[model samples]
Target chain A: MDHNKRYEICFSKEKDLGEFLKEAKGLNYSSFVFFEINDVLDIGEIETDFRVFKGIEIHKKDIGDIKSDISTYRSKVDYLAVKARDNRVKEVLSKDKRVDCLVDCFGRRNDFDYVVAENCKRNDVAIEFNFGKLLRCSGYERSMLVRKFHRSLKLVRKYGSPLILTMKPSTVFDLRGFREFFSLIKSIGFSKEDLIYSNNYFKRLIERNCEFDKDEFVEPGIEKV
Target chain B: MRFRKPSLEDKKRYIGFYIESEERLGRKEVLNELWSTGLSFLGEAEMAETGFWVHDCFDDQLIVEVRDGYVDEILAVVSLVNEIKNERVRLDLLGVAGTIRKLKKSFILNQEK
Candidate 1:
């Protein structure tokens, strides 16, 4: 609360994690969540001055497969994300409190409307703003990506949904410090208040998920079947 | 060494920065790319007001001079510059100061040595 919004998510599948963590810490991040599950990439024993969490991202396309994967990996991981292309599947994941984030894999055909954004807000599921592709492309490709992001940002702001901004870095060089990251998002129309809102949401997400061992934990807005 | 009145002169800032690259880059290439990227982000009119200049750059330690009230625009421009000559790079802010002397003393000098 006293400091900047210095939390991040690294989706790196590479093994050069030592350099990544060093760059992250040097760039003034206080905490980071890694969304890869490989045991070989473990940095638990590494003497780091920042917090790191193990997260799992489910890429199942079928609705049934997604539900199964969420249940299977929900408890095993500190954070859980699902990529759903079907609107119905997106709705299902939005309504499911067990899911932490919903990754928008649907490309330029952008399917995230006001309804999806509102649903995510109602369910507390965060929408990711991945700048990896943006950084990789140039000219027309980058322009189109920026246009797509503007549309998503408009909906996210209107609905007050929990939003997470990340570069989706796969390497140390791909990473950016908090200042640069914030500036990039701000250029896309994200306001300072939006950044603060995101910071508080992450704090809450981490606080609730910290007690993962207990069975009594209940996600807000969930009802008994 | 008669100088113009302080109030009549332009107020500029020497902002310190660093470029982390996959390989060493030339001064002209780096500035050319930065100016190009900065122009795209700031547009022609706003960029003219910036009075932007790459005061000195060595071993990726960069110091840029810009007009006042445009610091965030500079940061945003620097942030958007992800590539230079097809090499992926990251630009980070070191600090901001009113003069080159203080900027070197505070941000770049110690790190370089």
Candidate 2:
């Protein structure tokens, strides 16, 4: 599958949100997902907008779950955002269909169904792991984090869709195009085949969610072997 | 903990550090200088009475605790400046003060990558 086919941008601030929405409009990206931290004002206001699929980060209190705060937030969000401590909470939230994506901050766990393995068949939920931050983390922390992330990916593949790779770049300097992204993933232990499948999965999600006139999009020719 | 006066070199580093000062140097030169160095800038009431400022900097995401009487506070500022200069280190200065004593070298260097 052509890696260029899949694309989704997560925006954390209001300014970036406005900028990306405008850019997506011009580019006519078929599907886009918007994530906002729950504290941001006017979160409910964005839900009505058709330009993007909206996901909000809600704390554990908002979701009525005693799991890790991060998992509670993930459960309430359209895209579940899990931090290092929230693995157990994420297990409970995965059962809900409202969660279309699961973002693991430390890339520790990958099981899409059941808190522990052997509960049910796997289902696909988009998973994102940040290589840049992991690389900058302490050597011990990085190795431990990556090992967990890889394990998560294996579990996801066996139970659900393969893991989705993301850079989670907080600043403009962190941005990388498709080629750079593929190379980075390779450096971080993803095989060429895994990279290709991850890209295809993301593209499919975008196509499934984004709505645009067929004529406006120049389908990047992608082939599956 | 017994307070140790900062060495001249430490003082120089604290005073010369380039942080945004609150106002022109006047009645509170030391206070303003500390504030300029990006200390808490606790306002007159907080500064004269408590000798600390409670302000957030670095795009307002960090919540720092600054006490005027504490040399560790100045040292904390120096550490923050160094960490910010090195992009790879992700220490939240404000969060640090809230969670630990600002003066402990180990506390500042705990997560330095």
Candidate 3:
């Protein structure tokens, strides 16, 4: 899959949003996933104006497990899911049809159109795996997490919903080319076909949401995957 | 800029340093000499009231209101110390969790530690 096809940008600070919007305007990708922290609500204010802003993702890292002290982590994942739904409900109730999709960063809690399932079960949303984080853990841990992750992918296939593969890269060095991405996916026991499906699904979502013209969408060249 | 492992007795002193960086290192050195101990960092909380500027080093350099002009380096150092202290607290939590898990297993086995 082409690196350009799986483009995603995450913004934590408000200033980065403007920079991202300006940069994304010049890109030829069909869809762009923008993950924003809840504190920076101003980005949402300018959402409609940004032509390339396909979907808005808000991450609430609250997975209420007693083992981890994730308390300080803003927006619990489940709470964020509900909040996104509520926002969607309110938008629809107001008769505003601009917002097409609301994606929950982690797994789904109530009702969400898309979910990013990392080492967890899948529902209506898409499953995204951080291959780097998985590989960083011990081999045993990696295998265990992969088993759970693969199960989630299977659910996505059965449900016939879209799936997206993301690196969740915080820095530029984390970016990978097509070959590296394919090899990493293969190492995690995912088939070539699964990788292709994820790439296509992600592209379609971007195309639909971004409203990119046919000429604007760049077709990613497939490698061995 | 530099970190050293505090002695067992100095743990408490270091904890004080973690909380209050106002004291000079001489005070810490004197405490280490008297008690032969060090302090452990518990954790850090963001100074919500402080205004900060991004420094060239990519660390948040806080603006500490002093007598006249603001001291940027001092605020940055204090913030870093607080961060280290907070990390220590997180480690302490992880340690507690591990201990609890072990105790639970031991209890199930009808064993006393």
Candidate 4:
């Protein structure tokens, strides 16, 4: 039976595009989202069955800086992810419609709560869950991190925020198959339907971003005549 | 030790998973990581109660047995293990079944192919 297996978009900074593509293909991912546009050049040179997309991840401490950065990089990248260093910046960016993804909620603290969840839902900003965190941490800190993720997931569910699962792998060694990812999240309390939704969300993001890149597309709702 | 009746015994689930890595890992390394991760996360007392076992281990794929209610915990432990002997690795879970026979028949054959 066909399981309708999900396609993963790995965010990698690894310089060797050929090796990265080989690893990603082995992991069954059809796409790789690079953190910078420069790394994406060699991707075109390598003959592969994977689609590469440029993404910009900004780490900002203030809302003003974030707003300016978003404006500068919004049209330049296919995916715009923000790692808010301050809780206030996170709150503002979570509610900002221009922000595509709000990641690294566990940067300094467990930055998720009912309020942030609500804002993300209202703005349609995706709440990203990175499995790489679980890989790095262990013992008491890991337990606490798991609890924080559980609590955040509860709030995200209650407010109905879009959920995104990412590996954020820096190298080929960090890549993982979709089933491995699902198993991790499934243990964290997400249902099978939720897993399916996460996959669909990534697929939709790629499609939407591709549409936005078109010259004929004027904006979210407008088009050139 | 007195054996419990079949109905009195706890129901179990078998999880089929494969290790994703370039280097081939031995069964010992896989078990070591599994126990280390499981013990660190769930603690020894809780892990013992889960009745975890490596039902079968192949070159790359393996089937782990766990108590019905504790499958999630086992999954958490397995997924958290990204390294073994300082080598990077990833565990991709294929499927879970009530019986090892069923799990193999349904998932193992397909994966082997």
Best by DockQ: 1
In model 4, which regions exceed 4 Å deviation? A1-3, A7-9, A26-30, A37-42, A62-64, A107-110, B1-13, B22-24, B68-70, B94-113
Give the DockQ (2 decimals) of all models.
Answer: 0.56, 0.02, 0.01, 0.49
Shift of residue B57 alpha carbon in model 4, Å: 3.7
Ranked candidates, highest lDDT first:
4, 1, 2, 3
In order, the interface RMSDs are 1.8, 15.3, 17.6, 2.3
Worst 10 residues of 4 chain A by lDDT: A36-45
| Tens digits of per-residue lDDT for model 3, B78-108 | 2212112112100000001113234334332
Q: Per-residue lDDT for A1-225 in model 1, tens only? A: 435746777776657666678766667777778886322125466568777777877877688877887777777777787876677888778888888888863465647777778889998899887776766666687787788878888888888888876777776777776777777777767777777777777767876677763565565444245
Task: Report the candidate with higher DockQ, 1 versus 2.
Answer: 1
lDDT of 4 by residue, A1-225 (tens): 123455544555666777777756545576667775222222456777877777777776667777888888887778888886567777888878878888778654646777788999888899888877778888777777778778888888888899887667776666666666666777767777777777787778778988988999997899998
Pairs with steric clashes in candidate 4: none
How large is the C-alpha RMSD of every model relative to the true structure?
A: 3.7, 16.0, 20.1, 3.5
In candidate 2, what fraction of native interface contacts survive? 0.00
Worst 10 residues of 1 chain A by lDDT: A37-46
Candidate 4's docking class is acceptable
Q: Please tell me what DockQ candidate 4 reaches.
A: 0.49
Chain B TM-scores, listed for every candidate in order, come to 0.90, 0.24, 0.18, 0.93
- lDDT value, residue A179 of candidate 1: 71
TM-score of chain B of 2: 0.24
TM-score leader: 1
Cα displacement (Å) at residue A109, model 1: 1.6
Q: What is the lDDT of residue B46 in candidate 4?
A: 89
What lDDT would each prediction earn against the true structure?
0.77, 0.42, 0.34, 0.77
